[model samples]
Target: MHLSIFKWSYIVTAVSLVVAFLYGGPSALFLCVILGILEISLSFDNAVINATILQRMSDFWQKIFLTVGIVIAVFGMRLVLPLVIVWLAAGLNPIAAFDLAMNPPADGAAYFPDGRASYETLLTDAHPIIAAFGGMFLLMLFLSWVFEEREHTWLSALERPLAKAGKLDAMAVLVSMIVLLVVSETLAEDAETVLFSGVVGIVLYLAVNGLGTLFEAGQEDDETTADTAVDKALAGANGTDTTDNPTADPSAVQSKARSGGPTQLVRATGKAGFFLFLYLEVLDASFSFDGVIGAFAITSDPIIIALGLGLIGAMFVRSLTVFLVRKGTLAEYVYLEHGAHWAIGALAAILMVSIGVHVNEIITGLLGVAFIGAAFLSSVRRNKALRARGEDPATVGAASH
Candidate 1:
């Protein structure tokens, strides 16, 4: 609710709009505005999920996310990534890829661009692979959320059943692989490529998630050790017998406090933060894949896509994340997280479906909005019910299941 949180977003939106206008004139400016709105609508749920992670990160890292992370989202994913996909897929070097991107063939005149496919053509050709990878990764995120047991439930009938089903070992992985196999066999033309890409997606998700968990465990251990060291230092300073053994090295305990107390804890936290940041980046990339591809439908201009989706849209999402964290939006709207994950599940399904059939960007945006909107309303009702029963809504469980 604080307007200050969105101060930069407003400034960036205005600057990006002016740049859009200067770059491509009135029509381009209009399209840029439209694209920005489209990106926001498609990515509102993304902000919610982002806030869940951002809240746990230190303020320093949060600032890095807004600054350095935005640059990667803007350039790395939206601009350079498309080019890289084309380069790798077509076996073209950087120069050739950039040249091809700059000079896309005219619509419907897809003979070939100088004995090679056009930029848009190649990117479209790469959709199945993108869908396979992004879809499976997002599906894993969704399944893990849905299958986990929780005290709170948005749709108890559906969630309760899923939670019970989750007791089976590796239920999420098994279901994801089965879905990947089904899609690859039935939907994809090149089943081998789709299957391979999907498997890679699943593996990458597990690796990143596992690394994050490992780092988090290390961080906890470091904090515990530092706390013990600090306590011993305090006891020694107070002339208390902290240890049972009279021969214990008091100097050693003091050295640990002086050397490893705050410094070692900070290092462990930073390492954990780095991996969590990496996880957020990957999640953002997976979410943006469909948007990046869908942007071509509006305009074939990469600069415009970056201006709208990156500068305007992505900046807004980051600001919204800050707002959610500061305002404790998720804690208030308990079902909101469930809604975002459901939206993600829907998106994963749409991505897999688009491997064979084209889905309009409008449909993709609407489905996300619908789920989130419904969840918000449901959350409001729950709050009212709790108030009527004389229970403090804020005290209820809001775990990130």
Candidate 2:
């Protein structure tokens, strides 16, 4: 609805057209446009998840996400990541990999002089590892969220059981590991690669998430200490026992926390924000694995892939993120975040299974859209039901003033 949110996307599309035209020709430009659209289609859910996280972040960090983060998303993940993958997989130096990307062999021809393998071929061959890693990482993210104990749930029947199961520490990680093992055994070849990559994904999630939790806990402890000291000082000045004052109103305390308390409670700052940024970048990379690989199907030209999918796609995704945050879409929809995570879970499963069996990209995109759409409709129904019951939808679960 906000045309301004899409302003950058429009500018990026125009720039991509010119660049694509100059780089190759009309055909190249057309491919660029198509790839850009594909990226957007494939990544809408990603934008939603990003908004869920971005809403928690401070405005300063949010700006950084849109600006510096866009650079990393577009150039770092889209361009450099592919090069790194090819370089590592093919044992080619970075320069050679870049050259191969720029000048890939004819459709079926091998690029290596010794007839070893083409860059595209090698990249394709690495799919199992890529899929396993990305799948596991995404799966872990979704599981952690779904299993978290919450007062309200979109899918109460299912989520309630999951929340109960979540009482066991590291339940999400344990389940993810079991799934990874099962998936690894199904791979015909490079099972080790799949297993190892999956382990790396799990470890990466634990490490990043653990760091965040540690810092958050530390911040909370510090705040509690400060608040306690202030309370004692006030009690001394008033010549009254601290306990004599009735306990502060819980709702008021919560309101204070929400408004004046450390915004760091939800969005990290300082060292924590840095790591949160890293986590986001890694998550984006995982989401992009399919898009990067799928781009090869559209065109073997890596430059075109980067221009359309990388640059243009990144812009639109960022725009969508800002739109969601500004409009308070997540809070309004209520179940939308739940649906996004469920979609993420499904995507993760599909990615892992695709290691042994190919899955259509269209199916992947549709699955996400379906989950999100269903959740949106469910939210609308819930809102109407609440209104019918003489309750304001906006006040649902909100702390009273």
Candidate 3:
């Protein structure tokens, strides 16, 4: 390992262990590290998107993001969230699950009977809901990618028809929910439970987005005027051709196009960062459900759950976000964001599916990883092709050579 790597690893490990010890003991500490690695691997794509946004925030907001954000992720999502779903779905009391997670011995004996996290009992009971949620998320992801082809003229034409009927978005959400309720309810009752939880999450996402957009302060930039008189004078000496009208300057087209689009894209993407952050977090949660449930396939200790999974795994995602930004991968890899968006859409569908069927977490995760991996590899190949041909890498952005 690099010397810097060793130092950061040691520090993070030491800090995590200390936190684990305060919560439970050595078992929790060990589990925290294991879960941390698992979460980081499953979530690197999330980090890339987060990095893209976080890099733009002021340091004060960045600090808030790392500190307060982690607490919300840990206590709010990891620790309490699963239990809340149990209450909302199975009619189990909220505090009952929390008390069970806290009172390890009591919950282990009475609720689980098999000596596991009571939350897992809730989830296993609600498998259909999880399957539906995951399935829907995966489906959404696939559709997003399918429609993203820039050169596909047919799709652009199809968009109008699809939009007119609201056939895509409404149909997707409605069909998935209907299937989860009608079919999964008959086959697996707990699946309905998971579906309810996912719907709640989607509602939350819509609300957050609405609020963010409402708060947005719009601004306009003054358009740049080209020095056409100076351009005409210089071009006259160089025997450059222009349109008969002096202002119809063909010579300046390249520079004007280059300047205009980038400024607009940067501004649009900057505004987009917050919404993207919300999407990424929601997407990460969808992916985490499988891992969280699967961990019960291993052990059920809440301390181990928090330490092994929460501290080590979830915490590291934050660090990974930092590393992605610091390394400047977004600037280097043009398609990384596209890959992430597609993966997110996939994960969302899979999450919806998990509510209704027994979609394996490993398969769901690999599907997302595969999508992103393909995009990244494609970006690399395109970059290498340009390099080999002695063309500027910047041409990747141009519509034509």
Candidate 4:
């Protein structure tokens, strides 16, 4: 598993090294390395959230995530997304936008002699709208988790109350909308643009995530019906009528089906899985918005950004995701998901706030790391307590389910 995961990292490193060196000697190579490191640091929480969702998917879907999904992440988001954004914002043709990105003017003047706009300047100018969209999307994600009732919690004091409040339908969306309004009012410029982008973000989240939920719910209903039918058939085969057994619990049968291992649980495949894939991709894009903008601090070269931050850094994140899923890391560190969501909430707020102020990328990275580290420590402590009580941590986790 380690070999399979690290192999991509090694290949990306070697390729990035060669590309960076050829681009502009040692200094460029160093910059590329720094960008890669920065991407990984900023995106560690992304890997954890991805693992949480990926583990529910079938092996085939998981493989798709690592293979085809990475391509979308590296090229589609890192390369084409910028061009598309520039094209849309500056009203330039795709070719012109690409050229402007590759060769930004020295004076940073956006309008060209040929009347084409500089892609970099246009992209930079679009940051507030971009931040608002991504920020709102991520904010909704964090709120949804906190609002939903869960078995384990890292911060019960706050989480318990939030979960209770979450019982109200669409409460997450309501809170997000209110926050978006507040943020829009605070923005000095492009208030309308930011608000519009935020509305689109919320709508997309609802449409995509809600569609995935509908599919998953339908699948679960089908599985339940099938399991109930099979249980009745087995009871008949044993010369016992299901009706005769007064204590025959239908929910127990469903529970057994769910816990019966990989085959019994409906694999996230077909239409349901595809929507889930879309959700993952959207989630990833939201997470990368800040990283994409922050990469400009390192260099404005689109190729180097694609090679270092997109290729190398994103590959490692994908690899880490698979590693987490395969190792059942989430199952072991029960509070890890909570911590990741908290980090996401912090990131969402930071992204929104950054519209009015400059928030350091280092602070963002450190906040995520701090939450994750604290969660790890809490998990360790809980495991130790369980061991002292003469209980196996693994057994306890399974039983809780």
Q: What is the per-residue lDDT of model 3 for residues 40-98, given as tens digits with 9 covering 90 to 100?
A: 67776677667766775545555555676767666666667677766765677887776
Candidate RMSDs in order: 4.3, 4.7, 7.9, 4.5
lDDT of 4 by residue, 162-240 (tens): 9999999999999999999998998638888899999999999999999888888888888777666757744744558
- Candidate 1 lDDT over 1-401, as tens digits, reads 66789999999999999999999999999999988998988899999999988877778789889999999999999999988988888898867887877777776444465676778888889999999999999999999889999888887878989999999989999999999999999999999999999999899899887887788888787777668667766685557855633454667767766776554524324877787788889899999999998988888788899999999999999999899999999999989998999999999999999999999978989999999999998888888887888887888653222
TM-score per candidate, in order? 0.88, 0.88, 0.67, 0.90
Per-model CA lDDT versus the true structure: 0.87, 0.83, 0.58, 0.85
lDDT winner among the candidates? 1
What stretches of model 4 exceed 4 Å from their correct place? 107-118, 241-263, 395-401
- Total backbone clashes of candidate 3, pairs 3 or more residues apart or in separate chains: 45
lDDT score, candidate 1, position 364: 88
Residue pairs of candidate 4 with colliding backbone atoms: none
Higher-scoring candidate on TM-score, 1 or 4: 4
For candidate 1, the per-residue lDDT at 154 reads 85
Candidate 3 regions with alpha-carbon error over 4 angstroms: 1-10, 18-27, 55-59, 90-95, 102-117, 127-202, 210-281, 398-401
Task: Looking at model 1, report the run of 10 residues with the lowest lDDT sum.
Answer: 260-269
